[model samples]
Target: MTEATATRTDAQATAPAKQTKKVHLIIERQDNPNSQPYTEEFLVDYVPGMNVIACLMAIQRNPVNKDGKPVAPVAWEMNCLEEVCGACMMVINGKPRQACSAIVDKLQQPIRLKPARTFPVVRDLVVDRSRMFEALKKIKAWIPIDGTYDLGPGPRMPERDRQWAYELSRCFTCGACVEACPNVNERSSYIGPFAISQARLFNAHPTGAMHREERLEALMGEGGIHECGNSQNCVQVCPKGIPLTTSIAAMNRQVTYYALGSWLKK
Candidate 1:
């Protein structure tokens, strides 16, 4: 082949691979807590192994819409991008989950992002998760300690029970279970699955058991375990794979016995 033709052929053979199409996202946005929500489209250069948070960062960096117009940067919460802090929780493509773990490659094209409506929308992809915290407070999901001095080593637990308790302790309070739960909507005061699971976790603790009856009583009150419709949605959407429904059932049995005991005394 001629020198010029040979060089051209080699160049053609060595041509770079076609660029990948950009990732498309339809994000539901709200200007403020009381403002109406609207959908906005964004396109970001596709990157290998990128997660939803990466896509959001791209949009944040550019703050441009699909139509090439500049806009306000989207607002969302995230911490410990490793998914431990549970601050990155949001509804991705209609499922409540952690955005940090939702890999872009696995997500469908034109992925939809929205705040979990189970909580009040703060803005854009941010939601007010205070209610879940309030529920936790209501149930007193904690071990009481005077903290005046070192209490020394606490009581021990059986190996099997400790292992199971460890699993329950994985809860990061992401509120994914609450968002998935139908019983936890605005019309109801349901304390939610994570709270129930947390109550169970603490109640099983050697030191925390001191307030077991109090937690059980909270679970038995209005907007308590009885409010659960048993739709089983909480367990399905939990990012930590916490056995929320199982906790609910166990707490239910405990509440039942507590009620019977209280009635007998009366």
Candidate 2:
């Protein structure tokens, strides 16, 4: 070969091999409730239809970093990979969502994962969702039954109301709505949107209507319905697409009527 051609061939051979595209994952992790949080980077093999949970599992199997150093396996919560169970909710790429449904293909490069900061981080991507359930208790988000005995075919619901009620019933207490809500932070006891929607759900039930006044009254109190700032972030993030803001507005109207009714009674 000519000297010039040989030089060009050698230069081409010496060129660095193009690094294969790897799935870069940066996870925010904490060892315990009181420990300082840290970030860990992991490069996992990319796979089609892979979700956050799958990536987490890959890390768990190898527990290695991008530098190929051995590390601790990632910890997270998951159930019903279909997103029906909200146990897998975490902040993925700056948005709170179900890890099982957060497909890697749809996420940005260097997928960032973090525990939902709106709640106490238990460890890694797992968070204590007890506050959400506690809010449910605060709102008494259920229909009270007189007894466990057979109450044959309880009061019927109108077809139209049932249609809307079905939408509210889809909430799995996933905590995504609460995580997405700015008003539900440490500074506020707003009880978040899910509880309010639950209250609306139960309140619409014919039998549940008996406690409608009580639910409304609870919502009227401190950390009640009025705390909602109407950011409307909850609706956008809810996997089930539960109409949260609509429930807030509907409950607001109901509470207003209940307040006026109580005044008339007085």
Candidate 3:
């Protein structure tokens, strides 16, 4: 064969490989809360800059599986695709993260998607994150006020303190930190790192400080800061980089101080 023809032949041989691009996903699906969980494999045409949410959307549009059979489209929750909502938290390839931010290009082949098992699975990828919210309530994660009449402006925080509090406030109740934490499993009632961080946030507020001792006491109770195993998985998996371990440590100190003070008074 001529050298030019040989080069053309080589190009022809390689063209098919380059032309065919696919994103493989193995998603864990649960039909209902009482049903057994199973896996479903999917293949989608690879697209540039595609995130897991995008891939799921494609699958939703097609509703076909790897076996060339029609199947129910996978279910998931998502909002604020920009990663602020944290509604799309799931275990992608064994790491809990936001599906909207998990770029396909950054993930390995046959990417595994599972519901954040720390919470009860509502469906395929949707989990009932109410537990985390309940934990928040347990710690009184909000400032209280009597709404009968308008209250004047509340106390202001220092600029430096405000900046850090802003960081803690970034938590959108996404369960990534809780999902990554081993102590936050079914048998454990550990409130997780986000609650401790939130307590820190509220405790810093001059008005919120009125309930600070109550929050501290809550943290000192069961499923509180003492339950943290110091695995540090929470800090690593947090999509917002919220310095969870730092919050946990700070809360630990605050709880200790409060307990000592209470004991002295008694």
Candidate 4:
């Protein structure tokens, strides 16, 4: 062969081969609440703009693992395909967040998925978030306006309060705060930071404030604000950036005053 052709052939032979890109997922799955947990590895074709949920959907479509064996499709929950619903929250890479928003490109290789430890695992990535909801119910996290109808617009809150209240209203009970909070584990009855912040949200409303005492009363009971360990993990994991710790302090003051007033009136 000619020298130039020989050099070209040598260079082409030494060049690295193009690698096929694929996403690696290490997911912890459970068949049932009482079932033993197991890990499954999955590999899906990498596509730009794909998120963790998208990767999981790809696996679901195929139901095959990294070993090329057919298996039960990994079970999980998702709604709205947006962050608002908070249905797909899980421990992604050791942080609890919405899977729909977990962009595969932004995540590190061998992305890990597990059910959040704060709640009971239903199956796979699905968890029972009912504890957080129960806390909401315990705090009466809603305004009541049903007597004989014609309640109309109720009352208006001051602009200053309304501005901050709007921020608090963004909470969709996503439970990220609860999941990150160390105080909200199996041993403690802490209502979680989200509930405390939610109590503040409704209490600031003019109409909602009318039932403020009731909410505060609930906050003073078991699984109330007093159970907070002040670890401040809730604020770090909250997707909405809600001022959870500040709300906790605010509610603490309310509870303190509430307890004092109750004693004085007796």
Candidate 5:
């Protein structure tokens, strides 16, 4: 072979190979509410832009562990893969975040997935968020528009206030704030930060402010704003960056005013 031809052939033969990799995942699993918890390891071929949810789906396709033993496919809740639904919240490497947004490339090797411990673990990486929902119910976190009729723009808010209110409206109830909060646990009745921010959202609205007294009263009750430890963990972990601490502080002032007013009324 000619020297130039041989050089070209060698280059073709020894071209750099694509670096394909398989991500390893260690999932904490529980078959049922009453079943004992266990760890299951899985290996999935890497694909560009793959998230943790995609890895779980890969394992679901073939229910086998790292040891190659057949096992039940892991169960999880996911909706709106864009992280808007907050249904796929889980503890990824000890940080609470939505699995849909947890890209494999950004994650550390041997990614660890677990259920958020702030709520009851129903199954693998799926916890019952009913407690937080119940807290919302307890506070009646909605504007009451009585009688089904077109009120036709009942009220309007100032542009500046509306801008701040819009920030509070971004909460998806993903539970990352709750999971990061130390006050939310089995023993404490703290309602968590999301609800407090929500209270602020509605209260800032001109029409919603009619029931501000009721909302403030609810915050004064058990599992209310007083339960907040002010550790500020909720703000740090909130994926939406909803300014939770500000809401908490605002509600704190409201609750204090309510208490003083009630005392003076007596």
Candidate 6:
């Protein structure tokens, strides 16, 4: 064998090993709803196809800080890791999103995760979304169905309307839109964009239309559709890309007509 060829083989064999990649995370944590929140940093080994949730799980297993101190396991909520349940929703890198679907590779370094401040914080990354649920209740966002008896096939809706309704129904009450909106805050009792969209969704339904007048009446009250600032932030941050602004617009028209009809009756 040639001496030059042997020398090249030895050089290739002695090459330095590839360095392991890591994901750096900065998480805002609150011990309880009333406790002061603080920041903690963690380093997690990077794995191919890993997501934000995966990074969190790694921290859970190690429970160590970037300073090498053993600490409490970072608490966060997650379910249906496919991004359907929305339980894993949090402020990721200043944008509200589902951690289960946030790919680690795509996010910028020093990824940040925080609880959505739109709702009361429960702990770490979990927040109380009851405000949205209460809004849904006030709007009567449901179709009145009779007893569980067999009522086969209610009225049918046109294909066009059904398609759009399906889009509005995609809201899982993740509170992303609420977090993005500037109007939703402690001082404001606004029912929020999702409730307005939900009101529109039910008002257009074949069976839900039965309560359409009632729904409109609820919206005409305080914290109804009038509270929206038209900031358009809700649609921009909505992960599902639901037509939130469009729904709010449609409900505005409905409320106007309802108000006019009531005035005429007086």
In candidate 6, stretches whose alpha carbon ends up further than 4 angstroms from where it belongs are: 1-18, 148-152
Model 3: lDDT of residue 207: 86
TM per candidate:
0.92, 0.91, 0.94, 0.92, 0.91, 0.91
Off by over 4 Å in 5: 1-20, 148-152
Cα displacement (Å) at residue 61, model 2: 0.6
The CA-based lDDT of model 5 is what? 0.90
lDDT of 6 by residue, 47-150 (tens): 99999999999999999999999998988889899978889999999999999989998999899999998889999998999888888999899987877798
Error of 6 at 29 (Å): 0.6
lDDT of 3 by residue, 128-178 (tens): 999888889989999997778999888878999999999999999998999
Give lDDT tens digits, candidate 1, residues 29-119.
Answer: 9999999899999999898999999999999999999999999999999999998999989999999999999999999988999999988
Cα RMSD (Å) per model? Answer: 4.0, 3.6, 2.1, 3.3, 3.9, 3.7
Best by lDDT: 3
Worst 10 contiguous positions by lDDT, candidate 2: 13-22
The 0-to-1 C-alpha lDDT of every candidate, in the order given, reads 0.91, 0.90, 0.93, 0.90, 0.90, 0.92
Q: Determine which window of 10 residues in candidate 5 has minimal summed lDDT.
A: 12-21
Clash totals in order: 0, 0, 0, 0, 0, 0
Off by over 4 Å in 2: 1-21, 146-149
- Candidate 2 residue pairs that clash: none
**Residue 8 accuracy (lDDT) in model 1:** 92
- On residues 1-28, what C-alpha lDDT tens digit does candidate 5 reach at each position? 6999999988777865734578899999
Q: For model 6, what is the error of residue 71's alpha carbon versus the real structure, in angstroms, after optimal superposition?
A: 0.9
